[model samples]
Target: MVNELSSTLSFPILIGDIGGTNARFALLTDAFAERREFPVVQTADFPSIDAAIQETVLDKTSVQPRTAILAIAGPIQGDEIPLTNAGWVIRPKTLIGDLGFESVLVINDFEAQALAVASLSAEDREQIGPGAIRPAASRVVLGPGTGLGVAGLLHAQHTWFPVPGEGGHVDMGPRTERDYQIWPYIERLDGRVSGEQLLCGRGIMHIYNAVCAADRKEATLETPADVTSAALAGKDPQAVETVSLFATYLGRLAGDMALLFMARGGVFLAGGISVKILPALKRPEFRIAFEDKAPHSALLATIPTFVVTHPMAALAGLAAFARAPQHFGVATEGRFWRS
Candidate 1:
């Protein structure tokens, strides 16, 4: 299925990485040219995506794009696509008519993240543990931000296929005695605690509050930043424990993905939180937890992990696809729309 949809798209392609909180855009003029990036805009600042594009992209640049390749922070289901954590419901047909584009391709945001994993250079990511990447092996990319996003990249027949899914919502349970204590205080969505419940931006606060509750102490940190700041500063015990436990849980999940995909190429951590918590992730706790799976612990120890350091990794991924769709096996049967 590699390059199945390559012929359907044309340049100059407008690529966007639409997340819950921010929307970033860039224009790809041709296959070999660099992308022309626009200023980042808050998703809430505009009433709709069309308006944001008009004000922030089209109006400012002279280059007119014939197609749009968007990676959104939600599933692409139908004509009306709602962002998972924002108020924007993207109507692709509406965009085609309004913006005079010939095609609009929408995909899950983490698919773009996975694409980034396939395309990023050595300097774009920082190694987290002691494992060498096995060439042409499948890989996993997950990020903890407004929410936890997860995806896998499979390499077959010299093509990279990005597998996008709700891996972040996978079932997460307590293992250690410390986890059992804090698990009770962790927020539950629906009735059970998922990986997202304890691995997102708010998840940091959840861990902090859980730590405070487990110790029968008052929770002082209100936001995820406050907790991370205090933890990084080493001034607050609860905050420090919260970050440590956060790293542990993140490692556990990353390891789970590595095993699930047999991601010998590597497992990448993207999103703002991963970059911010680099120091903590570099510590022994994260790697120890990652390699803790008893039966397959040795296997996990051989799989590398990294933190994606590029600021606009999603955009870079989209640009890579826009530049040469033939290199990626992106399934666009239902996701692709044309005027």
Candidate 2:
């Protein structure tokens, strides 16, 4: 059970941002001290969370942590929490017993992203288009990586609330004539395509292959990087088209999310793909498609969008919460555990 009066975490906190491919860890010695971050390690390299923390953190640092705050790339439920795209399962009870931590708090990865949106500095993000941020209004953050992630940040009662959900799996269908022509060739998950199907890393390759199929040409690009490189270099027309269509679809999704929450604060893009495709997102195609909504086009134009530039955005967010939990209203009824 959660202790409503226990608003502060102990000193020497362990914060982690665990995703499908990589896991990053950091240590906060005290309330005012700066976070000490360690090098990133692949999730596949470690069998479990404790092993990774043992080798990457405990083995290297002498600082012992009293509590842990982890943000994983999946929903937080039960003692055995499994990642959506990764193979490892996190057992919080096991972590406390093995690591000698007093308590553990688990949150959805995108929830951490939303927390970052609330606390990030101006230079931590780069604006993609023209619009002003309404300070007290709600905001949204979504990203494309090993999979898609979406979250909302609501401001109420002088506190920031991070709302996490499986918004990445929302339905997405073709709208443009070009999209219709290429849709048939694009692979489907269970006979239909979700937003992640065409907006993630594999989605890049899917778009490339579909564009090739539509154009009656053999696809030579093997990876998403190859497609993006070719497109950025203007060396392959197919690669260029794939990236353009990707930007358009991403914009459409961003616009939809903005309207859903009435996110006048801003819509932030945070992930490995969003950072890599900064140039593509900055192009006219992204903003144009974002503002193409018929009735709310003007409203969307007034709402800003940004690419989170912080390298360890999730860690920063967790650090923020660790420093001052009272500032953010993160739900921890079932997610918080203590021994």
Candidate 3:
């Protein structure tokens, strides 16, 4: 796949950022040109990847792109790409031929996000902690969206490398006594506690339910938006508490990912949930939880964290790769693509 796709670097390549709920597509026509305007299409509205592309992209673009790269919300596994949260699976065997593209490169969404970090400016993100990104240093990107996505980026010899993994599924524990009390209830649902169990959008509902259960209260929230709305309005104390715990748990996982990747370049947070719950994340509790790792407490404090606000970050990253494949250390070797 590397040899096949790597040799096709050209102008006007199709670049897409796909997730469980939304799909965004753009055309990168030049090395430094701004990402071409694109639209956000609902994932549920389209039955398959090719259908989504044909309706939202192919019919709209006049460039007639022959090559493409897509950043997906799931693992880019062999033959088939399985989305962890949505009911979509990308089968490369019949996909490219159907799309009428010469070849296509598929990658993890967070990996594309990690690639976008290379070109991010101050205005592109909001800082949550107190450290700066070191030039050419290793950085990590993670987000709580339809599910939690994690990846690391490193630079060596002018090439940005993306290390993708299912880090969100790792077993996690609580820090506070309140957390201890509520975790038992959450544990009953999943049998095991992973970061995604209580950090993503549905995770917010889980935390809200657990908090309500521990307080012997009823759950009024049915979705993540409801939790955020009720909490921000101060209409529901349980929702407020749930968002607080959500930040702490997210901070914990973000800090852990930073440590695992030695993300001295900084940690970039993405996802729909993170953006919607910005107020809770800005509180001191989030920072405290992030820097709470003892012994390395001071070390974690030195790593900066930010919330990605750019809607097209993953697309931008994929654009960078489509512009110059040699500029990234992306895991594409031995990867397969059908045409």
TM values, all candidates: 0.98, 0.98, 0.94
- Model 2 global lDDT (CA atoms, 0 to 1): 0.92
Candidate 1 C-alpha lDDT tens digits along 229-330: 899999899999999999999999999999999999999999999999999999999999999988999999999999999999999999998878899989
Give the local distance difference test score of model 1.
Answer: 0.93
- Comparing 1 and 3 on TM-score, the stronger one: 1
- lDDT on C-alpha atoms for all candidate structures: 0.93, 0.92, 0.81
Off by over 4 Å in 2: 1-8
- Candidate 3: lDDT over CA atoms? 0.81
Error of 3 at 261 (Å): 1.2
The 10 consecutive residues of candidate 2 with the worst lDDT sum are 1-10
Candidate 1: which stretches are off by over 4 Å? Answer: 1-4
Each candidate's number of clashing pairs is 0, 0, 2
